[model samples]
Target: MIVIQAKLIFLNQQDKQIVLDLMRRWSSCMKFAYKRLLEGYDRKTLKRDLQGTFDLNSRYVDDAIMKARGVLESSRQLDNNPKKVIFGGRDLFGKLQKRHINGKEYQKLKTKWQERRKGNLYSRGDKSKKGNLNTRIEVKENGTFLRINVGERKYVYARIEAGYKKNKRREELLQEIAESNIPYSVELKLKNGNIYAYFAIEEEYPEIKITKEKGVIGIDINAHPGNISWTEVDEKGNLISYGNIPMPELASGSKDKKEYFRWQYAHEIVKIAKEKGKAIVIEKLDIKEKGKRGDFSGRKSRRIRHSFSYKSLLSKIKTLAKREGIEVIEVNPSYTSIIGMLKYAPQYMITKDVAAAYVIARRGLGLQEKIPDNYIKFLNALTVDELEELREHVKKTVRNKHIKKKHLREINKAMEFLQSLESKPGRVLEPLDGTSFSAYDFWRVLKVAVVTPLSPEKVKRDFSVLKELLIQGKWGGP
Candidate 1:
């Protein structure tokens, strides 16, 4: 899908003011709907209440309620002490110009909000507003022209430019509309004393081929401002290409500069995919949820999380790729960082971020993630007698006066299991008391031994590597 915006070229100033008046009304409706949402009104109740509050049609009120709710939800997710979502009086115009809601248009607006700042509902602008009701714009295809509804009983007719024909080499909105069998969505926006109509053009493309012959480009998004690590892999998941694309500091300094940099970076990535004839693979992330729950811990973590616009980056790349007829694949993000750090990074002699990207690409290609040889070699070299000695050492280290009886029992059971496993190498031990000793548990034992004189730093490191390997599905079940 590609979006093309054309200036709404009203015949006179009176025609423009007529639409601006409706925008003000839209602003009022959004404020009203926002207040209702703050009072915890659900959609059903809000829709009913909006009918009595706003002098607009039921559909207009419904869309306003929806937009207001979205604004509040977005603010809460991004802001630590989020301010109330309010569209002020300085600018009260938007692109939501149709009565019936358009899914792609709504998504586009939502993306804009997601990419916006703490207190603002929309991107900060002198002429633009947050709650532009889209119900006012309507588009219909005439013989060789297009008719657009600007305001109440007002219409603007536009002729199709000769250059924007179906056989044109470039992707034009009119050409896409002519070829598309489905309905098209239109957006009306007020910017710098001009009315602009944006048309979302969806085109049908063939399904992307997912086979061993073609490779995948995996991208690992980082919180470090503008750092995008990527790797290309073949059908069997062998590494083909890998590099980090460094962007300028995406800090909260200048919005326009940041936007320009992001645009350039996304195109650079898309260019690589287009040239290589590969599918783009990215980790499916929910940064808002991660940030809200305090999952991203540490001092600089919050700053990094807030600053890094992973969603926006992905959104731009996806949009650009669609324009070029390229495919994008999203994969699960579990342990890509940890597994990358422990296994792929050192083995491939690349940064952990790049390694993670490589792993993500392999996952997209439906291949298994692997641990490094050095770690595997260390695990294979471990003797059963040595495990017994290590267990006994761990027991001695933890034999403190303050140690609880329950913990002692757990240690005893863990040690006994190790001894049993010495003789019964392939035996699958039953989970003890509805709990299991993961590789982390083994690492903890080694750590305890290290605290005493029983074990050394090298032993702890070796066991840590084994722990990671075990958790990574190296030895079957943890």
Candidate 2:
């Protein structure tokens, strides 16, 4: 389903005020629906009760109930606390919108709205004097055009115009509306003192069948701008092309500007996927949890998180892909960034963020887990606890010895090397820098007697070889 919005052109203020009055009346009806819901009334009972209170058309009252129910359902989904379930308010009903009506019923409703305006109850100044006794306005829809009952034949019965003129896009939109089989809903939004109508149109589309192609494109979504990354991989999970693409810097832009950029990035990503004949792969990220964490709990962090617009970007990509007959895949995000940073990043000589994308894409392609050679060997040679103990011992020894800053750097490097080995599957190494002490010295420092002593140099050299092997595996592809 898609919504097309157009500005309503008004030749006079009277027509505009008619729409405004209708909006106010609609809001009142929605609140009544909310009240019934809060009172624990069932849909049928609520509809029955609302019909007496709101003397508007049955369709208008029914639409308000539907919208109120939506508000309640959304609140329920957001929180379990009853106190948090917000009721229908002025903002929600400020724009008139209703969903799912039959064509014949809609036509009848339109005729009723126009005809009812002629009655004494809605007769101009009589409505002002009679107040609640006066008949209220109702919303109507016919395909892309929204019809408003303005009481006269030529006063305010014009169709809402979608004001898209650049490159004649408006014509195309009209054509699309004409071809649509089901126009789901119509909405009236008051923006900048103008009434804008939005039509949610749905057309029958062929089901998407995704066939494995040359490769998949992995997208890594991050909090910052210019850090969003994408990687193209062949069917066997070998990297074809990888790089970081700058997302719109939403942090420092106007709301409209930010929206434009967000769509721009989504469209560009989709275009690239289509051009390469690859399915788009992305991490299924939920930023709400992240935003609640200590690091991201600050106001700035919240803004940054909101700016990423992961959901919006995904929606746009999927919508465009559906039209283009491309497949989009979502993968579990667990440890993808870590794997990309520790192993794939170095091998592919790309940023860790991009490598994360590589991992995501490979996962979508159903590639086997890539393991570092050192991790496989370490998996057998030492337990996770033992590796952790060694890391601690190195850290304490360096602190106690008051080792020179330069030599201490080497110790930290060794710890980092150890950490890389542990990050692989079947091993969990606490991130630490190792001491310059070789395996022989390492054993001596801990006062352990062993039948064989391994040199620190030999161990470090071996680690280097394993790293190289892992990189080679990547180059060889699946």
Candidate 3:
């Protein structure tokens, strides 16, 4: 089922008071419990570090008062020292952000409480000193919120209140979340200006089919402004078109590459739909939930992630493809990159303004040395084999802006190395440099050794010929 989850962020003052109040109450309760525990204290009967256990009682509000205490005592012994306790320690849930959490905040608090602690009820710093106590804490639904002080350099949780914008923005933050992949979607819109955005999710369903003949789409992931993967399916769903856009540059990932990848991919879907009535097969994705990552990295990452409309483009593709009578199916696109496009021809987009750089490189494109690989894939003076491969993948993925310098340097090295064609009768020496260089042109160009640093692959085929003839003797290093 298609589902969407949104997070709204806001900041205000009223919420801060609620946080401090709860802390104060929690601290008093802990002090009372400590007095009782001391009365019942028996070195053998006493759980352990008496002080740490009491502090843990209030912090782990949701924990079994008994379980929390037991854990605290055990934890105390682990450190073999008593931690300092604080009364409602420093300010954590400042009045600024009131609504910065989700439905699962309470559970999160309980879980965090069980971890090692250095301070009192609130996750704090020194053994005795109160930490900002940045552990998670569950808040009451009557607008109660929980937050931490960013850098007091401690572990703690302070319960507060969820305010207007802060409350709306709670779900907006997330960290490294799960994956979400869809066939064709509307790409997210980005504003160079304001944080505001406006768009309704566009949804549709199309007939899906399974192809008997599976195809493979090779992908060239690039780290540029955006990403583009190559994709194509034959008459029988056998991926055909052997090219696509390079990976895109993401502040944190490969978005541009994916954008162009889908754009070019959709064109193919439309084309195929018009030809043979077939369904487009892709992975079903849920951008919302997958981006939630159980609340890591805070809400900012999630908010910004939603900003890129990868789905928007997909929606358009579906519309156009459906009009052409094409069916769409979703296969798991998870790990498609590492899998080397097992059943699909991944597409990478070149310039919308011009053909991909590889196309130019194949034809012996010339350029100044300073240009990045976005401009040149093959060194202007590369050997024929290298040039051919460059046209397909390497050239596009690499950012050899220093074309003149890097290009000539690579060529000279190759030439000198290729000339040292020597093989000893008893043993063979592998070309150190070429072993791990871009042989997207030459499959398995890496001796399998240079390619994998930890676990090296043995040559299943003859290699002395290749090793001695080229890439050895300081051509360069892996």
- Would you list the rank order by TM-score, best first? 2, 1, 3
TM-score of each: 0.44, 0.46, 0.27
TM-score of 1: 0.44
Worst 10 residues of 1 by lDDT: 118-127
lDDT of candidate 1? 0.55
The order by descending lDDT is 1, 2, 3
Identify the leading candidate in terms of lDDT: 1
Query: Candidate 1: where are CA atoms >4 Å away?
Result: 1-213, 291-304, 377-478
Q: Write the per-residue lDDT of candidate 3 for residues 326-359, one digit (tens) a residue.
A: 5544443333321131101112222211122222
Best by TM-score: 2
Tens-digit lDDT track for model 1 on 1-478?
A: 6565555555567755665565556557767777767877788887776666655555556666767877788878887333434353211224444446569876665444422311111111111221122322222222223353343555545443323334222223343343223344544455545555555544555455532258888998776545899998887889988988886556554543454455567888888888888889987765454443476753234543567666667767776676666788888876676566555654566776887898899888877654345443443344446545644654566555444333444445545545544455554332233345444333333223222232321111122433344344343232
Candidate 2 lDDT? 0.54
How high is the CA lDDT of each candidate model? 0.55, 0.54, 0.32
* Model 2 lDDT tens row, 243-322: 76676465566533554565557778888887888888876655554443567764445644656566656666665676
